[model samples]
Target: MRFDDIDARMRVFETNHDHCVLPGLYIVARIDGRSFTRLTRERHPFEAPYDPRFRDLMLETVQHLMNCGFQAIYAYTQSDEISILFHPNESSFSRKERKFISILAGEASARFSLSLGDVAAFDARISLLPSQNLVIDYFRWRMEDASRNCLNGHCYWSLREEGISAGDATQQLKGMSNPQKHDLIFARGKNFNDLPSWQKRGSGVYWQEVSVSGVNPMTGQEKNTARRSLVTDIELPLGEPYEDLLASILLDGVANRSPILEDVK
Candidate 1:
């Protein structure tokens, strides 16, 4: 076969199933570490349940994505997973799902691997939410998941400290209710409520606009320019309060002339 003919035939397989997200819908790309158990255990032995050191690495990855010339509005990270919210009008790479997934996963993998000083991999999936309410609920869903994980982690670690094997600790938490787990953790004299909010709610990253005073060297006059930057939110609210905050950010992201979710370049 001719070189051009062979090239065209092979390219079809790559693009045959390519799908693009619809316009006017919120785009959330979730990236999760692959085989993190073996990875962490074999090379990076991080603290069980939660670790700020690991959290900061993920935060660096999230910040890179937000500033990577995408119209990302918000980013949330918990455990070894990250969720990035993009504005409805995002048209990068023609909204191709595979492009977003591959690049994001690659970006996260690179960022994490660099921080950990070892190879790490992340896979990504995109979620398209049609309505504002659904978008709000989507974040709340992740937040609630973090809460449940926090409770279970505390219970399991408490048992492990008591000399229970990892398998036994897992089984114990599996049969316990939320209240039971809370009680079990409290019995260790470690109040789950006293834990850091980031441990329970995960961490959030969003763009903030600030005003900076600048003096024009040529004009000799002071001028104020609006600056955009990323802010890490650890003490995020839960339940309805979180919904309200997300709603405000969502509205602002899609609003006309809004500063959030703009191209960094």
Candidate 2:
């Protein structure tokens, strides 16, 4: 067989089932740390439940992903997972599902591992939302989940500090109501409401234009310029307000002007 014929024949196996996200749909990538429980608790001496160091590492990873060659509009991180909302018209890799999954997972894992000075892995899945409302609901879903995780984590760690066995702590919280869990932590002199908002609602990253004041070298005159930059928001709002925020980002003129999905395959 000719070289070109052989190359084409072999490429089919790799590309045969390649799936691309449909046009006009919203693409969100949910990337999660793999086996992070062992990685954080057993291997590393990270503080229990939540650690500022770990949180900073996660924030850096999110910031990296936002700028890593994709038109990511927003990103949310809580616990060991990060969810990214892409611009509706993103055309990277022809919007191929596998490409997004593999590259995002690889990038997150590599970035996080390098930052932590240890090997850590992450897996990613793409969610194809058909409407803007669904995109809002998707992030709302994650925010609520972060609330639950935050409550549960505080409760668990409080019990553990009192020398409760891991199995016993798990059993104790198994069927407890949210109010009951809050009471459990409150009894230990910690108010659930007083915990950091970032721990409860997760953090978000988005692009914003800021006015930068600079001196012009040629004219030696002060000037104000608009520059686009990423804003890491640890104090995210909740419920309807959060939904409104996502809607605003989606409706931003810059987001609307992003590149449309191209026919690259």
Candidate 3:
């Protein structure tokens, strides 16, 4: 065998036996909302496949969590559900996982409601997992769900337009499995590259500020102020996958009050 393969096998073997170093708190957040589907259908009635706006909003929500003090916050979307990851040592928000989930859902719902002129709601569930394997399984389940939903029909159609078919896409995804589950989370280097350049650069989030001009909900009067805000671009550990970095930051935030660092050891 090649030296690299042998080394990789050795590392895997060591990781499999090491119990202490792998223990860290993991938060698996599932975000859901009916509004997303409704808005997607309404906005892209003829698209018959995907809505770029929906995807943009979801990414924005993920970015919001990352900026709000979550370390290693990585988000992946399938259907209307967004799976988010966080590392254990970071502590930028109190009730970190729950708060971010709630905030993300609320922001998505508000944006959709306001932009579409319809009522909407989003909800999320945060859970702690014991092992990285479980996290991997969770992502696999979501990916399978996305495939079953016709290759994330709402998201895949866009990929298909670019020549990626549903069946081939699903198989390609399955081939790129990761025990760490970080592979499953969306990253700027991977999935982000598939997006339009404007989105990759986060123009949609910024444009929301310029496009929205109306009465302020809280003030109940006409307002010229920008309502939408962009989350700061967080710097991640060098060479780390975006999802892993996001997870680290989020876990740090959650670990502030709870002593869960040992779990990731």
Which candidate comes out best when scored by lDDT? 2
Query: Per-residue lDDT tens digits of candidate 2, residues 1-265?
Result: 8999999999999999999988899999999999999999999979989999999999989988887889988899999999998887889999999999999999999999999999999999999999989999999999889999999999999999999999999999999999999889999998988899999999998876666789999999999977666788888987888888888888873444643322111
Worst 10 residues of 1 by lDDT: 256-265
Model 2 pairs in collision: none
Query: Among these predicted structures, which one has the highest TM-score?
Result: 2
lDDT, model 1: 0.85
lDDT values for all models: 0.85, 0.89, 0.49
Sort by lDDT, best first: 2, 1, 3
lDDT of 1 by residue, 106-204 (tens): 988998889888889999999999999998888889988998888887888788888999998888778777878888888889788899999999988
**TM-score, prediction 2:** 0.95
Tell me the number of clashing residue pairs for each predicted model: 0, 0, 31
Residue 146 error, candidate 3, Å:
1.4
The predicted structure with the larger lDDT, 2 or 3, is 2
Window of ten residues with lowest summed lDDT in model 2: 256-265
